[model samples]
Target chain A: EPEVTQTPSHQVTQMGQEVILRCVPISNHLYFYWYRQILGQKVEFLVSFYNNEISEKSEIFDDQFSVERPDGSNFTLKIRSTKLEDSAMYFCASSPPTDTDTQYFGPGTRLTVL
Target chain B: AQKVTQAQTEISVVEKEDVTLDCVYETRDTTYYLFWYKQPPSGELVFLIRRNSFDEQNEISGRYSWNFQKSTSSFNFTITASQVVDSAVYFCALMDYGQNFVFGPGTRLSVLP
Candidate 1:
């Protein structure tokens, strides 16, 4: 089965540095989303992207965070400046443009900022 | 505000034992969706099931079953004859028509052999 895939399975960056996490959603899917989970915490929604634009974002998705579907398959999340709290497992998910509401997720990218 | 609550923070079961994970949700929207996902030690979120508010049907697939109760606003999952491979943190999530996805703190299930 086709699945969402993310690049740089693990990333380490210095605090205050910019980082980009990339994802290639399932082919033919329409809606895309980004979520994060701090160690030992519940997954928190960051933002949702559709039609190459942000559809919705959470309070945690402040000015430091931005998402782009620079190409047909590549969807990327950029953090303008990483904070220690930004260290977490970032996941990408996509749902097909259908009546069903299932959103398939990718193996997360573990971001570690020091 | 939409919220999902997984009351059981962790559960331990012997191999071949049946385990049930409890989930309760709070949502004001008349129309919404519920979902369950499993995160193994490797930390990948695997979609297990999805149910809409209108459908209160109980579903069974292999050793897995789901109970959706709109009256109590609960969606519970059960694993029958679970194996060691079933050990993982399972999360229950809710999403309203407005597309706000809220996840509950996951229940970590440890199936011992």
Candidate 2:
């Protein structure tokens, strides 16, 4: 089965530096989402994108966070300035237009902000 | 407001023993969706099951079964004859129409051999 895939499975960056986490959702899926889980914490929603635009974003998705579908298959999450708290497992997910309620998640990118 | 609650923080069972993970949700919308995901030691979230509010049917797939009770707003998962591979953290999530998924604090299950 086709699955969501993310790049840079493990990323280490200095605090205050910018970082980009990339994801390639399922080929035909329309909606995309980003979620994060701090170590030992519940996964938190960050943002959702459809038609190349942000459809919904949570409070944690502040100014420092931005998502872009720069190309047909590549969806990227950029953190303007990484903070220690930003260190977490960032997951990308997608759902087909017909089945928006069921999302398929990627393996996740472990971002470690030093 | 939408919320998902997984009351059991952790559970332990010997191999072949059955285990159940509880999930309760609060949502005002008459139409909503519930889901369960598993995250093993590798830290990857694996999709397990999804159920909508309208379908309260109890479903069984192999050794895994799901109980969807809309009256109590609970979606529970049961693993029958669990193996060592069943050891993982399972998450229950709730989502309203046109909204993001609200995940519950996961329940970690340690199936010992």
lDDT per prediction? 0.93, 0.93
Candidate 2: CAPRI quality band: medium
Report the Cα RMSD per candidate. 1.5, 1.7
lDDT (Cα, 0-100) at B40 in candidate 2: 96
How many steric clashes does model 2 contain? Answer: 0
Model 2 iRMS: 1.8
Off by over 4 Å in 1: A98-100
What are the per-residue Cα lDDT tens digits for candidate 2 across B28-58?
A: 8988889899999989988788888899889
Docking class of 1: medium
Give the C-alpha miss distance for residue A14 in model 2, angstroms: 2.0
Worst 10 residues of 2 chain B by lDDT: B93-102
What tens-digit string does per-residue lDDT give for candidate 2 at A16-77? 99999999999999999999999999988899999989998888999999999998999999
Superposed on the true chain A, the predicted chain A of model 2 yields a TM-score of 0.98
lDDT of 2 at B24: 97
For model 2, which pairs clash? none
